[model samples]
Each structure stands twice: as C-alpha cells, then as structure tokens.
Target: MTKIKIKESKASTSIPTANPENLKKQHRKKKRKILWKNKVKHVGKKKEDTKAMRVLPPKAPQEFSSNWKTLQELLKQKATSFDKSLPVTQTYSKNHTSKKENVKGIPAISGGGKMGKFKSVNKMDCDPAQTSVPLATLKSERTATDKNSTEGKGNSKEHKKRKNSDIEKEQADIKHKRRKSEEHMEQHLEADIWFDDVDPDDIEAAIGPEAAKVARRKMGIEDKPQLSVEQVLVKEKAFAGLTKAVAMDCEMVGVGPQGEDSILARVSIVNQFGKCIYDKHVKPTEKVTDYRTAVSGIRPKDLKKGEEFKSVQKEVADILKGRILVGHAVHNDLKILFLDHPKKKIRDTQRYKPFRKEVKSGRPSLKLLCEKLLNVKVQTSEHCSIQDAQAAMRLYTLVKKQWEANINAKSKRKCVA
Candidate 1:
C-alpha cells in the first residue's frame, strides 16, 4: 500500500562510494605538497641560523660541524687554483716499509642501514671531517713519486746535491725578501720619526728657519685635525708605556788643552714618545777652552743660568735609575756625567748591529741614521741635543722588540748559568 506514495525520487537512494585508487592518489599528492613546504621551511631556517652564527665566537671542535663544513667547502674551491701536495709522513717499522707504500684507505660508510638506526659510527669519517683530496691530485702525486724514484735509481748522490743546492737557493731568496721587507718598513716608518712634541720656535732657535718650517708643517700648528676618542686613547696608552724608557744626549764643551777633552755643557733627555722630559745647561767644573758654539748651540749666556754640575748629576742619576737608557754613544754621555749604568740597561743606537747594517758603517752617527732610516735631516746648522736625543729614541723604537729580546735572552742565560 506504501508503493502508491513511493513514486520515483529525483535523488539517488544508494550512498555514493569513493574510488579507492583516486583517494590514494589525492592523499599522496597532499602529502607530497606538505613535505615540499616543510623542506623549504627547514632549509630557510638553517640558512638564517648560519648567518646569525657568523658574528659569534668560534665554537669548540665538538660544538660545531656546520663551520667545519663551510671551511672544507672554501678549501675545496681554493684547491682549484692553489693546490698543494700534502707532506708525506713515514712510519718506522721492524719490517722496513717501501717509501711508496699506499696510504691506508678510509673505512667505508658504517652504521648506515635500518638496523644501525642510520646513525654514524665513525665520527671522523663524517662529511665535515672526511678528506676531500681530489682524485686527480692523488694520481699526480703518485706519478711524481714514481718519476723521482726512477730518476734517483742511478745518481742518488747527484740528486741529493741538487736538492741541497735548491734548499740553499730558497734560503737566499728568503733572506733577500726579508731585507726588502725591512727596507719597506723603514720607508713607511719615516713619517713617525718627526718630533711632533718639539715646538716650532725651539726648532727655529736651535736649528734654522728651514727646519722650523718643516716642524711647523709636521706638527700641524695651524691646521691640526681633531682626533677622535679612540685615537686619543691609543696615543695616551703609547705615551704611558714610554715612562719606562728614556733617551739622553749631552752637548760637550772642550775643557782640556788643545780643546780635545770635553765636558758636559747641556744635557737633554727625551721619553720614547720624543717628548723632552729633562733639559738643563750645566756649569762645568773645568773651565771651557772651546764652547763649540757652531755644534753644541751652547752660548756663554745659556750656561750663565745653568744648574750646578753635582746637582745635575744627582738628578740625572735618580731619573735614569731602574730605567732603560737609550741614546747615541751612551757610554760617552755616562762617562762625562761621572755615572755608571748597567751595560744591559743601555740601548745604544750607534752600536746596534741592525742600525750599523742599515748604514753600512762600523759606527753609524745619529745624524746619518736619522737621515737614512728616519728620512729627517738633523744638525743642519746648530746641533740641538734635544733633537739628537729624539732621533736616537726613534731609532731605538724601530728595533725595540729585537733589542729587548736580545737583552732578555742574555739575562736569562746568565741567570741560568
């Protein structure tokens, strides 16, 4: 009886079923898209991390792997142009091994299967630590070794002699390069030798108008550039270290008959920074036979307002005590002052072997050294003891490291003995 109302419906009564194969295809496509997006995100994050890590301090070997990989990549790229053969290492054995014995092969990739959980067993064999020596390099090295072995088969002594000669040539080339480098350094350091602290008026009064003009330009009296905080700090630090070292030069006036024997007339001392620390004219005990007006710049009036010789000597001794004394012909200065300083405590620019080598003279004068190494001409007219002292100090500063090292080494040896 319900068939009377159950006319044919427009919509399908049976539930529509999805195709299993189609469903599987759609699912795989969705999964593939998701995986691609995740991979891109992961790579972007890794790149960002690498960029951030660049500014940080280098991590310990165990703490970093990405940096090691980057270094390896750089080395690999450089190897294309700057390929260098690795030095061969030999292992002494009871059974003598052949010189051309093959390097032990790196073990194959281990712990790489499903059973191994895909974890690396040999850490050193990992990508970061693995040797990236090119196949071509190995082949070339093998051929080179073979060639050497064959060549030395008959004339080993001649080969050895040739090798020794090559080594000697290499040493000579190294020495030449070193000499050139030192000359270059001297040229560059020329600007640093100028006495910046010396007053223009003093230069004019002591030397001449020409030197004073040069000093004015160098000192930048009119157009001195404002120094930044960093520069000022650096300058202060440099000058602070100069307190331990001082340079002295004494102007002598001839006292004995024939005007040969000299006595100190004017003494000038400067610090490492070329700043005058002590300057005073001394009233000599012996009567002056020759004032040496042209060289010493010590006029009769200048010595009229001079300090007593005994007082000057005591003051100089106090200042020089436990301090490095640098000067040209320092022994002569000490002799005239009637003071004794430890030989090790003195740095004589005149006797310095390197300075002598530079001038190519047995005893290079301070003026010659100043002109040659410092590129500053001094003693133009009247010799200024202050200027001479500054020159000696600058020369000492040039080889300060080597000079101190020699003194320290000698002292250490003496102590040990």
Candidate 2:
C-alpha cells in the first residue's frame, strides 16, 4: 500500500469576542442589580431606625428660660456630670426643639426663626438674685405638681372614660386578631372579689356547707350555731332509731410471707348517731409481718393487750347480725372477720352508686367518702377505726331513705322474678 499525502484545512486561531452592544447591556444589567440591592438595604435600615426619628411633643421654653440663672448655677454645681452626660444632639427638628426648651437662654447659630425654634437669650437682662429658689427645690415642686396633676386627672370621670375607651379599642383590635374561643377565655380572665357581702348560706348552697365554713373563716365572719368537735364525736346519748344501723371499720396488719395478706388488728363499731358501740384491738392468729402503723394506728403494745381474735369475731358477729351493716368496703371487713352477712342489709359506702358518682371513680376510699358526703376529714395522719366507723355510719345516714327504698325495690323485683 502506497502512503497518500493530504493538505490541512486553514482556519483562524484567534478567539471570538462578544458583541459590544451585548457587553454594554450586560454591564448595565450588572450595575442595575448592585444599585437595586443597595437601595433595598438602605430602605430596610431606615425602617428599623424609625424610632430614632420619632417626634416628641414640644415642651414649654418658659420654664427653663425664666430660671436660666438658676439652671446655670445647677449646671455649674454638677459641671463634671453635665459635661460627661451631654448626649449627642440629633440633627432632627424634634431633638433641636427639646434641647432649646431645656436650655432656652443659649443662642442658636442657625435656624433661629423657624417654627418651634427658640430665639437668643440675653444673660445680662435677668438678675441671678431675683429668684433665689434652688434648682433642687424647683425639681421637687415640679414632681409634686406632676403627681397632683395625675391624681386630679384620675379623679375626673371624663378622663376615666377616655382611658377606658382607649383600652376597649386596643382590646377590640387584639380580639380581631384572636379566635372567638380566645375572646371567650379573655372575658372569663377578669375576676371579682365580693367577700364582704357574701352570705355563707348562699355559698353553702352553691358549693358545700364545709367549703362555706372555710370561706367564712377566711373572711373573719362569725360562725353560726354549730356542734363542737367533741359534741360531734361523742353524742351525750345514742339515738334509739340508730340501734338497727351500725357502721363497722377494721384495722388490719400485714401477714403471710410477703406481708401482702391482711389480718384483723383492731375493730370499731359506731351507731348512726355518731356514738361508738364497740371498739377493741384483736390479737391476730397469724404472726404479724407488717404492723402498718403509719396507716392502721396500731402499735405492738396494743396488739399484745388485745382480746383473742375468736372472741372479738364472735362479738362483732353478734352486733352485726340481722342489722343494716354500714361500712366502707364492708366485704373486706367481713372477710377479715371470717364471717358472712346478708348482702341486702349491707350498706358499703365504697360500693354506693351515688358516692362513686361524686368521687368520679369506681373505688372511693373511706376518707374521700367522708370528705365528699359528710364534709368531714378523717384518717388524716393515722387511721382511727372509731372515727372511720362513725364517718361511714354518718355517710349511710345521709342517703338512708333513698338507699333503703332502692334495696326494698330490688328485693320486690327479685321476689316477682
């Protein structure tokens, strides 16, 4: 094969330049962008600094002008502070006017005849000794005058109306920005106190007699004729009607290997009239694992001196037999005693429908029941069996009619079935 020689095509080696008009246009566009950015930044800065440019109300120049000599003397007294504390005066008209009003006797090098501007002061015209009032005294007087003016303004109903109207306008504006629910809540935020004219009977009707008593106590109001604590706790004589109804409470100590099992430690029975019928500490058959002294209020000494469990059980059974048994969680009490009672005759405050409803929970404690229904506090620190029994009996008495009627209605229905 023969090698063939070929000539190369000729082309320009120089780089191509852009159109001059296009370059000019690009340059103009670049310049405009920079100028626009600069303009935007300047506008934003001015908006932020608007507070600095705010105009204040013009002050009377006569106050400072008349007391120029006294003011000069005052300035001289604190020359160091006056020189050091001299603020950088703004070029704004408001700032100039304020400065002129403060030191009115000073001559202005420029802008003397303009509106809100002060003329030159001649120091020679006024005698320094004419008004001998000290600057300190004048300042105090000015403060007193200002206070008096504010008080006088506050006393005026028209001023009050204007202030209230202004407040209402602001509130209306805010309400427009908020939701209807928020406005409703804002209306409720305002609270009024009228303790002086509050009748405790009215309060009792509204809240409860117990809460009313508390309110009355706080207000230093005289209490109504009520039973004393001793009287409430121990009645002089038991009511004959309460013999059939009795409330019993048991205090138990922990037993078994883990101390979870409960055994009867003490027993208390109270009649419907808040009178204790029977109270005794019972010695447990099993060895006590936990005394539960914090809650049960039973000590080792009490248990040592307690009666036999069998004897106490028999006594309790005899008292509770064929009677309306009132207790908080009476099932637990009966279980601990190893005895059974008729369910129809049992009035357990814990299981009561009305009580559970008020408590807003299925299991209501003895303390809670007493507080809610009887408006009495019991078992505050240590469990008092007698107090609890009394509380439970009182609770039963509160709804005795409704409770008995319901029981009768249930029995009748059962008989029909």
Candidate 3:
C-alpha cells in the first residue's frame, strides 16, 4: 500500500548529436578490432591433419658399390662358361707317329670321309697321246669352225638385203602400173561442154543483136574482155532523181513473253539505184530477251558494238525526214521505229496491186514478188536486211512508172471529189 515517486531518466528523452568524422573514426577502430579478433582466431587454431599438409621425408643419395661388385662377378662367370664351351684340338707327340704315315705329311680326312694325303701327279702321265698330237691340226679345226659361223652370219645379212631389194622393186613396179592405168584413162576420157553451142547469127535473127550478144555471154560461149585497172576503179553510178526515195528494211528481235515482243535490232536502207544508204545495228533500251537470228539475221554478236537506241532513232529520223519511204511492210517498220510518215509518201511493195495478181484483200510477200516479177530470189534461209531492202527497191523500180501514174490518178480523183 506504499506508493514511492521516482525521477525519470533524461537520457531516453533527448538525442545526442556527434561529429560525423569522429563517428567514422570510431566505426573504423571497431572494424579493426573485429578483423584482429578474426585473424587471431584463425592463427591460434591448429591446422587439419590432412595428407596434403604432411611433410615428406628426403630421399637418400644413390651408391653403386654393391651393384658394381655384382656386375663384375657376372662378367667373370660369363668368361669361365665361354672358355669351357670352346672346342679343343688334340696334339700327338713325335713318338706316337706310324711308319706308313711318316713317309708323307699328316693324313687329313676330307668331306668324303676318306683318309688320304695330297700328292703331286705328272700331267704327261694322264694322257700321253693327247700331248703327242700336233698343234697345227687343232688350229685348223678352230679356224674351220670360225669360218662356218662367219659364213652363216654373212648368208643371213645377204638374204635380208635381197629381200629388201625385191620388196622395193615390187613397189616400184606397182607404182609404174598405176601411172600407166591413169594415163590410159585420161587419154580415153573426153572433156565436157557446159553449154550448147548457139549460133550467134541465129540468135540475132530470133531476137536482136544486142540480145544475142547477152545470150552468148550467159551461155559461156563468149567471154567478156577483162576491164583495165582504170575501169575497175570507176565509182558507182550516182542516184540522180531518186534522192527523195529510199527503201528501208528493219530486222526485229524478241524481248518479252517467250520472245513474242518485237524489238528493232537492225535497220538497212537502200537508194533507188539499189545502193546501200544506211545500215546500223540498234541496241535496245530494255534487256534483249531474244535474237530472232533465223529470220532477222541478227546475232547477239551483231549488237555488241551497236549504237544506242536513242542515237540510232535520231539518225534514222534525220535520214527519213521529208523523204518517200519504200519498204515491204512500211507500216510495221515505222511502228517498230516509233516513227510516223505521211500515207502518200509511203510506198509498200506488199500493198502494190500490180505486184500480185490478187487485186484485193491478200497481200504478197516481198520475197514472192521478187521471185515472180523481178525474177530474183531473196530470203532463202536467214533474211539479210540489206538484201531485202535491195530486193524491195528493185521491185519498186520495176513498176515505178506505172505505180506513180496510178498514184497520181488516184490523187487527182480525190482532189476532184
């Protein structure tokens, strides 16, 4: 029942502030004490009794005294055994010799197991008759044998030479017979005449004298006199009035879709006189997909040094400017060139009614027209653009007057209407 009042401790109510540096120093000292305690604990305890911790004893130095004594004893024993195994030859005293063996040297047994003594024998006593024979007879026999052998060898060599000579003679005879036979055949055969001999006077009577001379020249019955170098150097005839007309032919290659698309590969142009005016290989802008060589005669190598498409187009356009264009299929060529020309200025051999018998609808190919009207063959295998252009120009020239007259009449009719 007694209640006593006690004072509260002030230390629990207020917090004390210490310097940071001093607190850090005290902390380091406490850490050092802890580390020192750990180090002492580690050093004071004994290490574990492991095999790795045991110390090995040092090895003793080697000595060769006992081994050397043993090796010397083994060598001495080997020498005694080798001497005991050797064979020994027996010796007899002079008093032990027999009287029969005393007449000669010691008798030795040979490999035949016979007791004998080596003795000298007289060579003359063996065969007295062979020695008595004269040396001249033996020399003659040897000489006879030598002569027989030499004769046999000589016969063989001579036979070989005779056989070679016979073979050569037979070959020469055979060659001579062949030459005779060839000469005989040549003498019997007659020369062939390619053409029949047509009388020039008769030819002149049938046609004209000029026509006869042409026929004689073609038949090979007459030869044209060779021209001199000056005549050979003469230039080709200039194209006079046909400056405005040029026949062009284009060769196309395939580019897309199984080579179905046509791309211009080469172009050939000829004047009215059938002389080459312009010829060029045109490189396509797009990659070449096909070379229609069989029909177009344009190979891959032809376009290796070809001009660019734009440059070629410009050159061709400049050449064709304000000129009458003549071709087999002029429209198709213009389409491939991406060019346009006036309808009146274009002369298509394909559409010319006079070239073919069919007046309407069907158009004849330039090759067919050349064969029928111009009497010239073209496009036999691979089409040559230059040859085709020339053929087209020839066909146009053949009917040039009639074609122009018909065209003029049509124009006049159109103007009147």
Candidate 4:
C-alpha cells in the first residue's frame, strides 16, 4: 500500500518494479476475504480504472531521413542588402554573460519513495548503457576535490591563491549583472556592412533646365517619378489638411576659383495651397565650384539660355502667394529668388531634427533626412531637384504630424486642467 524506492547500485545487479501482474497478485492476496465473498468473471467487460501500458520487448532497429529539396532551393537564391542599421548601444563595458558553475545535491533515499545516487550526465557517455546523472552529484564531487587538495597543501603560493579568489569573485559579480541585462536585451539579431564613399560621381554634366513643364521627369528617372500638382494635392490631402506648404529646391552653379564662390546656378521655389507653382533654374555668370557641382550634379554646360530669371521670379511669387513656404536651410532658396521673403511664413525643418546641432545623425543632405525620418530614400546617386523638393515636403509633413499631435495633446491637457 506504500511506494518503496528500492535502489540498485554496486550492492545489487537488479531492481524490483510494480508490474501489473505483480500488483494484481499483491491486491488479491491482501483482500482474500472480500474476493472470496464476491467472485467475478474476467470474460466480457473492461475496467475503466485499469488503463496500464502493456509491457513488451524493446523496439527493433530503424533508420531516419528528411527531405533535402528545401535546402537546395535556398542555396540557389543568394541575396544581399544593406538595411540592417540599428540604434547604437550605450556602452561596451555594460555587456556581460554568465552560466551556472554548480548544482546542489539530491537527498539520499533509504527505502522511501525518494530519488538518490545522482550521476554526471555531462556528455559522460553517449552509449546506450548511459544512466541519467543528477548535476548536483558532479558539483559536490568538484567541491570536495578542491577542499581536499587545499587541506593537503600547508603552504600554497599566497599570491596565486589570492588571485584565484579575486577572479572568482569578479566572475560571480559579472554573472549577476549579465543575468539582469539579458531580460532587457531579448531582441531580433541583425548585421550590416560599413562603407563610406562620400560621393562617387562619374559624369559632370550640368543639370539640364528645370524639368520642362510638359516633359515629365518621371519618364526618364526610375526612382523619382515627377508628381503632378494634382498628384501632390491628392497625397497631401490624404495625409493632412489641403492647406499644405511646398518646398522647391533649385541648385545653381558656383563661380569662384580662390575667393568665395559666386552663384553660378540658381534653385528657385514657389509655395502655395490650391495654386499653380513655378520652380526654375538660372544659368550662372561664372564657373560652377567643384563642391557645389558635385552636390547639385549641375555641370557647366546644362544651364542654357531659354527663359529670363526676371520672368520666372514673377511666376514664383504668384504660385507661393497662398501657401506656406517650407524648406530646409531656406535662406539660400529665398536669396536665389532675389526677393528676401518674410521670415514669418517660412518653416525651416533645419531649425529642428535631422539638421539640428543636437542630432548627430541629421545630415544637411535632404536624402539622408528623408531616409532616416520618412523611411523613404530619395536620390543618393544623383541630384534630382524635383526628388529633393518632394523629399523635403514629405519630411516636413512627417515632422508636422508629430508636432501637431504634441500640440493637440498639450492643448487638451490645458483645457481639462
């Protein structure tokens, strides 16, 4: 009626088990008087309570295999990407890891239903004759060995002993910190390549006249499709209100050799809501500077004599009459138009993120800002005025969304309190 944990070790070669037949015999012997009074047949019905597993000889040998078709398909399609950038870690010194060095022993069993005789299962033997060993046993053995050795040595090197003790203490501390840190760092693993080619320009062709009003720049460029005013209006309305601002960027050639460079190329802009806008490029009076040319992708030959700047500036003012002026570092844009616009209406994101002095990642380049904030990568290989302008607008709207949300939250809080 009681469980007996009879252990088998060097003293015995075999162990006893409570098999179904043995158990049945024991039950019949124990309640002989009750069984004799009420005799039953073992013929028809099965007992719901007796759901014991059938005893049989060990299983026969077998082989296992898996399909290799999936592996072959994966090997054929080797791909590459550079999209694994992530937030930088705080510090290298904070990183740590640790593992268990010891396990406690299992209590000894003496005819009770308790486990005993733990064995080391740490790759002790892969053979079929292997037995499960409790980790506690190995830890105790290791501890005893160290204690006995230390007892035998009367005068071990003091310095070496002290060094070992210090190292062990340090390891324990590291283990504690590592355990704490691991919980917060459960994240997706990733990798990337580090390469920096400032600008790899092959051609120096001056940028052609601002995209022809009729000739769609979208047709020629694959990455940057020119958006019509109608398309822009639709997109802007879909995201925010119809009262939107436009940021037009025009890059002109620089004329200078030794002194400060002269404006050889001009980027013009017009911003307005529900109105046609004009953006134009002007031919510089002198040579385009090396740096300016590299950035704007405008060559000495692209700025041709087609329309006068005086005529273009008038259209710029007319288009930008109703809409707000938006730009990144807009002083240059306003100066190029030759009409120092009012400071009140212009919104410069350069005054904020991705360009602010505090944000190290924010670059003066529009493409980088667009990529970092909007998750949309603009032209990086070549400079496209239309693409840059659109990117600025997209970036502005993204920033405004956050700004508006914050403003509305504060307004509500003020009203409630």
- Which predicted model would earn the best lDDT? 2
Runs in model 1 deviating more than 4 A are 1-242
Tens-place lDDT per residue, model 2, 23-94, is 788789999999999999999999889966653432555444544555455434333334445655532443
- TM-scores for all predictions: 0.43, 0.48, 0.44, 0.36
Among all windows of 10 consecutive residues in model 2, the one with the lowest summed lDDT is: 107-116
Model 3 clash pairs are none
Ranking by lDDT: 2, 1, 3, 4
lDDT of 4 at 136: 57
Q: Could you report the Cα RMSD, in angstroms, for every candidate shown?
A: 29.7, 22.0, 34.1, 34.3
Instruction: Name the top TM-score candidate.
Output: 2
Give a tens-digit lDDT track for model 1, residues 197-298. 888766654555556666666666663344442232122434533478899999989888977999889888888787778999998788888999998998
CA lDDT of each prediction against the hidden true structure:
0.72, 0.73, 0.68, 0.50
TM-score of structure candidate 2: 0.48
Per-residue lDDT over 204-305 for candidate 3, one digit per residue giving the tens place of the 0 to 100 score: 544444555555655766743544422221226766334678989999999887888888899888887777778899887677787878898888889887
